[model samples]
Target: MAKVAVLGAGSWGTALSIVLADNQHEVRLWTHRTEQAKKINQTRRNDQYLDAVIPEAITAYSDLKQAIAGVTAVVFVVPTKAIREVARQVDPLISPETTIIHASKGIEPVTLKRVSQMIGEELTAFKEEEIVVLSGPSHAEEVALRQPTTVTVSSVDPDRARLTQDLFINESFRVYTSPDVLGIELGGALKNIIALGAGISDGLGYGDNAKAALMTRGLAEIARLGTSLGANPLSFLGLPGVGDLIVTCTSVHSRNWRAGNLLGKGNKLEDVLEQMGMVVEGVRTVKAAYQFAKEQQVEMPITEGIYQVLFEGKQPKDVVGQLMSRNKRQEMDDLAQLLMERYSQ
Candidate 1:
């Protein structure tokens, strides 16, 4: 019965808190908003973000230090934009021995740093190998309902990864361990870009054929970039890779997909964001990825197209046409090039 602190009061954080509580761990769910914390404690529910009741073993706290005190593990479930601030706050309060785990998935725009990288940058007390990432195709809504969901945990240290796996695994929520931290994080982050593209395709009334093509080619693009960044190419075919892409692109629960759908239906980016009232991670990730790909000289036409539509004022239909009109190439060129590079490395 370890004491765990889950930062952020969003759906994912709350659901994960429920999981810990269910497993007989004492859970401290921290939200920045005092009202939210009080409400959850009073009603045992987080009505705004989650539909299910929070467990009795889970306690909500607005004080960051109080929530983290004596906890053996601290799970970060905040947004990418908020990670640094939260980490800075946590650095002074948390013990160096507390295991750090982050479940957020997105790349920082200017820095192009993954969520784990951002946390590591802020929390100097812990070694890089101590950081763990929890990611996969699981959605908070379904997980809250105790529906079967599987996810992967990865770290530079195999022991740390397995420790994190043990912290979250159960019959309904299966956890797997992997050594390819770079591949897992990259796959989880980059898949959102493709999900947005998929939503746009659907919103534009494109049939199954177009979406299927987009998903397949999007996986190729993700694998291409992941391999360039020292990730194992085969990891792209796993749960955090192809599995995540499929779910985010196809599910209505995806904020990124919903945002892209609105854009495809002719809404402006600002209006779409305002209407959604949630952080559509894909929007920011597309921008960061566009710059990163340019720097690395990687080919990512689908991501480029989405970037243009979201930031450059290009019409969604026009971007689609541009993508289709690109010069033809062999299907396996990307894979072959990546494999050659991998072997040479």
Candidate 2:
């Protein structure tokens, strides 16, 4: 069996470590906190992050070198912001042959780089094809409970993605592969922004109709921006796209959606983030997407509206009005607009 290192011990990280352990692989699950690692090793209970018991095959470590040594693969589940630092620390510990997989979903606000890109930049020894992105609608809580879940892996090298597929796929966790790395990353990262919007809509007491419209149109904006960046528009239609959007927007497990729900209920951005006690990626994602939209001249009214609420201190109610008051567009099906001839390239 292949040995793997899973960085970060948060909900997502712990869940993925469980997947690896269940697959019977020797998993080195690393956390930055020494006390947490000791607790995990002693009790097999990552109580703060995952409610499920970590399998015996998985070992927790606070040392980066000990966790990565001789591992054939490394799974990065850290927050987007910590990706660079962790990757840099792991770079000297693992060989160039160690395949890198990242499930951290978000774009860097400064460089607007996807998590894989950040890893690639920091782990200068690993080539672009070595990086694989795993994303879909699966929630950490569900996955930890061994609930049936599906996710997709993407890379520049289809073979590499397929290899990752074999490592994680099991009866409870199904894995798929896609060639559209750009689209996969875009869909995964941006859906959190839409989910935040969905939460805001729910927070405002806008019934299903309002949320329906928001989700539908929010998808349009995602496809629009994704296609402009040269990602296959069809990727937005797959697991990484609409599948992810639906789960994150609708599920209570989604931190982004929950954060938006708090914002919708009149909490300030700082207050919402502080109260959640976990990283709300969509808050940062919206800002990056908004900046990218402006730079690319793409129309992302929903993202723009959310950005205003989160950063500009605009009221959620007022942003809703602004979104509704925007100029008209053709009522054509979003499918037509998203998959138009121009995006075929």
Q: Candidate 2 on 1-345: residue-level lDDT in tens? A: 999999999999999999988999999999999999999999989888778988999999998889988899999999998998888888778777778899989999979888888888888788766699999998999999999999999999787899899999999999999988889999999999999999998998888999889888888888888888898888998999999999999999999999999999888888888899999999889989999999999888899999989888899999988988888878564556657675666
RMSD of each: 1.3, 1.3
Give the lDDT of residue 9 in candidate 2.
Answer: 95
Report the C-alpha lDDT of model 1 over 1-345, residue by residue, as the tens digit.
Answer: 999999999999999998888889999999999999999999999989989999999999999989999999999999999999999999999877789999999999988999988898899798666799999998899999999999999999887888888889998999999999899999999999999999999899998999999999999999988888889998888999999999999999898889889888999999999998878888889989998899999999999999999999999999999999999889978766677777787
Using lDDT, give the best candidate's number. 1
Per-model TM-score on C-alpha atoms: 0.97, 0.97
> Which stretches of candidate 1 lie above 4 Å from their native place?
336-345
Residue 26 Cα positional deviation in candidate 2, in Å, after optimal superposition: 0.5
